[model samples]
Target: MILHTNDVFKVTRPEDIFETRGRFAYFRVELLSQKGNIDVSLKLTGRLDWTFTRSITLTRKTNDKGVAVFPVGRICESLIQGTKSNLITYVITASEYDHAGPALYAVPGFADREILPEWGDGENISQFYPAAPCIVVYPNAGFEQSLFFPKQTGELFVLTPSSTTTEKYIGNSAFSPIIPFDPAKIPSEDLGKPLAVGATPTDYNAEIRTYYDYCTKGIFLKWTDAAGIPYLYRWTQESKTDEMSVESTYHQLDDTLTPRDVQNKTLAKRYTLHSRIVERDVFNLCRTILGCQDLFMYDPDVGNWVRFMVEDSESEDTGAPMQDLVVEIVRYEYL
Candidate 1:
């Protein structure tokens, strides 16, 4: 498989992302020697040679399905991303003593491959009929016997595994099942106003930004000041005093402008005009202008949450117009 650093392979104890949204999902690893039942536990390793150093014991028994469920014992304050570097290590050995054992599995190439392909590829779990339906109520809440997720009360959805479009929604075991986009209606009229379409109880901030390659050093942005002079802001992360811990930082680059560009130029004039260099305040600029930043934030802690982006020229390869700057807003909940 083609390995990519940005690829994510979700890991779980055979549950759904919606079910394990706010927790670390783990699997039940059992050891059985010729002597009958051999005790074994699971461990975790990281990029820095960091290891859990403890064998997490499994207490559940394997049913006729050969599937075993185990309780994590205590709530864990950890978060695992399919696209990150943290690896899950399963160690099987005797649980009675404090000794290391064989490493059952090591996710050395997890970042390059999807741990749960059927689940990750938008395939429905109901089609596969998993070992058992498991959901995570909260992070570090420990593995509980029963859990519940929110479901629409009166929503009608077609479930046909054979037909792709009119097909059934798979993986409905999560707290929130996927809502298929309705294609039976016409496009909503653009009333020349901004509309919000994303997660609610907003947990982010919005800003208009511009980014260009920083030669060969890194990446920087151009933020317009009150005088319309662009100022360079080096992207970085900081702590937010909200719900979780420190949140992801967004690099905001917004500017206010008059409707001068759109007002004077005629329809024909706008089409005929070519390249023009406009001057603003003095700030360092980069060589390659990446694109207009609709919403830009970088948290050394939190990661990117960009749902989509609208290009200026209606083309992915072009830049935005002069009069119009990027507009980006995000909802954030403080820790």
Candidate 2:
């Protein structure tokens, strides 16, 4: 559970388990002797079809408190390649003497978002589910279907109205579904409109994500977490105003009324989005939209993801659910 780089040896350490010995209950026997200056080592071995193949071992001498300091999160992070999401499964073995402790199974994902995958009581799937249930995708964007959905054991199928394709997981490392959706299969009129596609292991549901996508139509904004998982949500109230800011001004010109530098003029788009957000989506918007590394709006007119940003704290106005439920996006463009 404790997977932070500096959190090791402080919060999460080996449990001191003791057993009873002798006929007298006063005498207690410990499974492992927790003595200072003792030799201790941690061995981490990957699970079935894991991405990381090499085994990791770290040896340390116990301190005065019989504590062996080992940073599990830091150790696992060193093996990660690139900035992509990595789903890892491994067993942790602690050794003090000749006897090896019980194998502790851990499934941790190091990605853009800080999603802690807890061990469910009857969890059978080897893969981890995204923190959010849905994603806001570009009409023709490509994404691995398995990354968004729980890895289903059966023959997974990705189907459209006009076609069907399949992927599997029993013997495969990961299954990726073709997501550059077909324009022909979709209604010509609805081709670029907002379509919330939901998924199951077998195939995609023929239904939309929310009922509002029908009645309360709006634009969807997208942002990714630290783990690189993207989240898209809809906001109906959209407005834009172009404000020109002059970096430098020169003498008065005939074409311009005021003394202005037309060549140095920059068009800053003051785009505003107003929407009544429900209780659940309020949190998702704050974390994903408010301080996102990159922000985009799905322009219904153009049917594309337009880059924009929430101007600043002042852009937000008081709203029922959250302060910034209504926000104006600002983007600067060279004229």
Candidate 3:
């Protein structure tokens, strides 16, 4: 098949940061083929591409009558470039096919935007509600939440742009190293058997772990959807301030542990496990509803973390109908 455009073009700035900067870029692709079945792939051919070197592929199959309007989607990673160039070069190639037909050359629209009005007009501000102590996450598509956690209070914005076509997680989503948290406590429901091994335990309080205070306090987590969409749920520690206690359980390091000592270890372990479960459950809930996969938690080692372990529907114990959807947590932070 004869290709329409020699190559595809994309435009972005500081190509390295797509997750926090929340910038938008325009992508243009030209398609040319004899029969329309152009088996083509697009790659970001730029120095900056290494920053977030990701790719998007579009496959068009001609209609029965040989007439097809191929739909192409642009992705942030696809437009990302390692080198600072005015225009990003994309190589589009196809295996030799039949002779070109009518020399059809179709150019897609550009998507780059000068400034995100949503960010400036305060459209996204409301979405960044405060989830004090810890934010509660639920399953809901098209609903997103965001918050800013500053190590030091200042005016600095981190952003990343996402394609409308990118696959987003719904509800009950899970990221890798899936940390399982106890589902929201039902008023009249009994929590089925204890959580599985290595899972976050329920009824955890502070005191036992010094780090819990840091993780739980000054936390600004925004539940959003695929492509960094925002929602309206907020969390506040004030409502339950009295409940924020650093209750501790002692650990009796003994060869022959006493019943009281065993209880203490169980309590300590439960506290730690509970924290993990909360993080995992909240993360998954956000991802499943948001519709973005690749869930990960930020760590010094990986530096850049992706959210994972998403489930879109309600669990068997929910006592509610399941919403078969994908959930994801796009952004989270602790100040």
Candidate 4:
């Protein structure tokens, strides 16, 4: 049997890990004591540069093989990614035991080991790179959430009724009793033009039309107060129509009646918040925003700046004393 040191605590997972999505990433840590696989409570503290430090407690116990295992739950990837230095340092310790160990480092996203500068002789060398947008999510009230787009200024379009195909009857239906109808012998004719009225009984055929709608039912704008608390302001239908024009032709009629024109004809119903917007607190903002099931933000998976909604808050957890907000990517946008 080998003797393990009391200070043999270390993070076993997430080695050199980088998270692109703003979802929770799971990790694990291990601790060893001189007593050989004894049950012990350990504190795991994660520090992200000078911005903030979050710590969670875990109990490590011996398994059937007398080996200790301590698996941590999902950790907010955004909180760990926005560090100034882009490095997250973790330390594990136990009050009753002397198993305080060296700190472990985890890096978020891709980072070059060395950014070598190009050598220039006499002329000034200019390097151009695209700017990445910064996105942040905070609570508006209780569970309601709001997003902050520091670099985004243009209007965002939220699509609805994803289906683009619609059916409309073009032929007149004639009365038919005991008509010898064979499903396999159904006539296939041009459904675009109106069918002529005939005395012989004929079934009314439906013409399928596909189109996309540019008119939005509503708009939710993200705003902040003097205290920097985020809130979502829903735009009225009129306001949405005005903003809709900036992105689409709201009143223009299509000559050919495209699929988009057909979709635009469908109107969306108005939505009302259950609770007064003024009565909501900042913590409950996410709850209210999520309650509006019809609303959808931009996707972030394909762009540098991704929009996320607050899924959970760490302030309520006693173990994690830090005020870290957990957010998941809702939408992605390039610009």
lDDT of 4 by residue, 1-335 (tens): 01234455433433222222212223333444334455556565666545577666666665444355444323433334454333333444443544444333332322222111221111221110000111112112112332221111112111112111222222211111001111112123321222211122231221111111122333334433221223443323231111111223344456675534222322222222221221112223333343232334322344232233323213232332222222221332221
What residue runs in model 4 are displaced by over 4 Å at the alpha carbon?
1-38, 48-51, 76-81, 93-95, 108-335
Query: Over the stretch 218-316, how does candidate 3's per-residue lDDT look in tens digits?
Result: 212333444333322322322111112233555565656643432311111100001122343343343333333233333335544344233333332
CA lDDT of each prediction against the hidden true structure: 0.24, 0.41, 0.26, 0.29
Total backbone collisions, model 3: 76
How high is each candidate's TM-score?
A: 0.23, 0.46, 0.25, 0.26
Q: State in Å the error of residue 123, model 2.
A: 18
Tens digits of lDDT, candidate 1, 1-335:
11111111111242222122113234544333223233334453222234433333444444443334443313111323332322233332233533332222121111111223132212232321211121111112111111111122222231222223323221122112222222111122311212111122131111102122222221123322221112232322221122233334444444654332221221110111111222111011211122333323323234432222212322122343332122222234332
- Model 3: lDDT equals 0.26
* Off by more than 4 A, model 3: 1-38, 44-89, 95-238, 241-253, 257-335
Ordered by lDDT, highest first, the candidates read 2, 4, 3, 1
Per-candidate clash tally = 29, 7, 76, 30
Best by lDDT: 2
TM-score of 4: 0.26
lDDT of 2 by residue, 22-125 (tens): 11111111223455676556564433333435457766677666566555554444433332223223332334233233323222232332222332211222
Residue 44 shift from truth in candidate 4, angstroms: 3.0
The TM-score measured for candidate 3 stands at: 0.25
Q: On a 0 to 100 scale, what is the lDDT of residue 299 in model 2?
A: 70
